[model samples]
Target: MTKYFRSNVDAMASYIPGEQPQHGTQIVKLNSNENPYPPSPAALAVLKNIDGEWLRRYPEPFGGEFRQAASKVLGVPSDWIVVGNGSDELLGLIVRACVEPGKKVVYPMPTYVLYRTLAEMQAAEIVEIPYSEDYSLPLEELVAVDGSVTFIASPNSPSGHLVTTNELRKLASQLSGVLVIDEAYIDFTEENALVLVEEYENVIIIRTLSKGYSLAGLRLGFGVANPKLLQGLFKVKDSYNIDAIACAIGTAAITDQVYKNACVAKIKASRNQLATDLKQLGFHVWDSQTNFLLVHPPQKKAEYLYQKLKEGGILIRYFKQPGLDDKLRISVGTDEQNQTLVKALSSLL
Candidate 1:
């Protein structure tokens, strides 16, 4: 088996996801930044009443209906978007299509570990630039690396800080290859780099229904870029990448902007409150634009709090890597759920 695998596949470290319990609803699930609210009623309606006969036919290639639904919302034409199983898949597609072995792949350090993993899969040269102490983009260093694909995760995970659009435009202009901005958590934030897509032909923005629309279980996401850039991805993607069920339900979800906005508003409110609660408990909380907060606990108790919270039936993210070993990333839950977490922390600390 060892001899059969590519050396890159054999040597690369696998991406470790947050813990997923057997009974998700049975516990306070906050380790993963999933939507706390139920899906849009319109989407649920489609889910419950999808025509069984449509399963017999292959799904419309490239999520035809969803592209149209998301078009009106994104203000992009259907052809400008390419649907995928999730933003993650589209990312892989980009790497596969662009990166030849030893070609460079660059991203900011401690932003998203998946960028490193994806680069390794391609056996590409990985260049990671460290963010400033305030988590500001190190634009000069990032642009210096001429990578085949450069990733920036806005409202970035683990830190929950957004790179400014002006900074992104600057980086995109200097980079020789595609600039992939992963905005999986953009719904919680007010400003985004969607405008950059229009200004830069090299830009591709990756978004998911998982966070904003309460569709984590559905695994549907899409990338918005110039049609010229997306044509290569379309050629490399699975013949029928999107399923008929997802097309129907995701269409319903994206169309109901009111419900999605309401859910995002609640999460943003909870995120603010949770940040305040952590600060009161002697944790240094960062100003966050995403639905999660990155906080440094008092007395270097990051691992202690992670274990104690789990023992109390609550889950939050703790990273053991350098620069993040002393911090924890908490996903915003329902008000009641967050109250339970804070009460537990108050008792433990």
Candidate 2:
């Protein structure tokens, strides 16, 4: 570690993102919860029509065009929306804006690991409330934590379960600090907590195009909250956080709700089939509301299956963390890719 690095920076372990192999290699990628479908045709059209001259100028600092489109779809006013390079960036922004050094940032254990890393970067105290044995949200425990910022990943990653809306509203009402509902995969779920933004000034809901819109490569995400909370986030955000092309393409993607919904429908169907196949193979599959499954295999260890699958040209996620060691997070992929995964697993077992 460098001598000049901040003590917190030196001590913190950076977040590990999903692996991305080199271009052109053959692999069935189910590690990252990325949409297997193509982005909306309207988004592609926007990219095709990008004027080279526009690249010479800076993008709208606050991503007005994208926010306007998101506003129309989400039914929130434009001022209540703030676009980021991705929801990850927005997560960091929330920590920086709401958490002071030594303040607390609370989240459920076994949720997205990035929340801990972000809090660590800010030198904030992390309060992790463990989920119930069934992996349901521990609403009472979370509400008791004296945190400056609380993160709840609805339809949480690694375990595709969602916290009930009533439970979330109760927690939000009881919390003393900012409540951030990270709804990255909520598109696949039946309901969302966006309505809480209008009901509670402290509630902020973040969403991304990565999973639902098939725009992971574009790095587009946004957060909606009361105008007051958004004003604070704006202060901490990068001056030109979003690029011009991303704004144009994101606007196109959000405007084409039909295309986005079509892709989501396909993924949801595939998720069900994948879970059923795994269950049939004697694996324990958690009921998922997102485009992925948290599966516990029948015989071999999760790490072993992960390695064997990789050798067989399929990739899935296996977290080395304590509670997740026995499970694998398999992203819902195209029909062909999913079949390849099932065939590979059948042979390994």
Candidate 3:
């Protein structure tokens, strides 16, 4: 007889995180869309002051300081915010809270990948709506699907395209179910879906401290939504989702707007320069509002470029997905590291 596992667990497909290669000290890692810079001095100062009791006691169940700071930063109320281990944890909780076995869950295909994985884990039927060639959401087709929840990312992963507010509002206004705007990369863009949360009771916006704050190691993220939506999610999450140190560092990061803004400015400038340089080298670069650029290399397959770079102690993302086989998603590294990658590519191509 088969072991007594949940039917969903038996068939669920897991999300594959980007490769974390550990070999050379000289590796210029641009594979995962991680911030190229280290966390601001403010975050480091908080970590430096950690006391003995900090590790002994369990973190506050509500993460009051973190919530209040995050709320103020986002211009949302603290009561409507719920912090998690990472946005990935929040995503999973959202799925479990809204979706039931056999219900439908919709998301754009070739998105974050976790959306489909989470839906399947919950035993929900997956409806992956394809994006247009420009990677814009097919808003009309999305609304036509019958699903308990829809997940969409602004400044989408791998593609680095932003979904416009008009189309997003159209879906939020018309859809009967929840609309989740995964804005993990929203810091890289000039616009966000957060403003729509006030108008649509069903809209939930997820944000992270990973990219802009350079705190991926902190594993801090939060959800902004109507109190009712948060209420549903609160029922599913672990009692104390965030740790004390992470909460402290996250709060500090949010409060230090000057430092965060400066870092973002540098990253945006570097991203633009890198994009232009890649295009000049005969690669087709996608317009990006995020920390990474997706480019079609001038010569050799994307896999070949990826492998060659890895061997040369440089790393960038390359996908084997059906439509994305020709592209590589390169996170903006330090100027020197990026130049190193370019030089290596020049030699190979």
| Tens-digit per-residue lDDT, 128-216, candidate 3 | 98887878778888889947999989979878999988889999998999999999998888988888999999999999999989998
C-alpha lDDT score of every prediction, in listed order: 0.91, 0.91, 0.88
Off by over 4 Å in 3: 1-4
Model 2: lDDT equals 0.91
lDDT of 2 by residue, 29-135 (tens): 99999999999999999999999976999888999998889989988899999899999999989999999999999999899999999999989999998887698
Q: What is the lDDT of residue 329 in candidate 3?
A: 91
Error of 2 at 267 (Å): 0.8
TM-score for each model: 0.98, 0.98, 0.97
The TM-score of predicted model 2 comes to 0.98
TM-score of model 1 vs. true structure: 0.98
Clashing pairs in 1: none
Candidate closer to the true structure by lDDT (higher is better), 1 or 3: 1
lDDT of 1 at 213: 95
Cα lDDT tens digits, model 1, 1-349, are 3497799989988899999999645789899999999999999999889897989998899899999999999998899999999888999999999999999999988888888898999899999988877998988888778688999999798788988899999999998899999999999887899998888999999999999999998999999999999989988999998999988999999999999999999998888888888899999999999888899999999999999999879999999988999999998999999999999999998
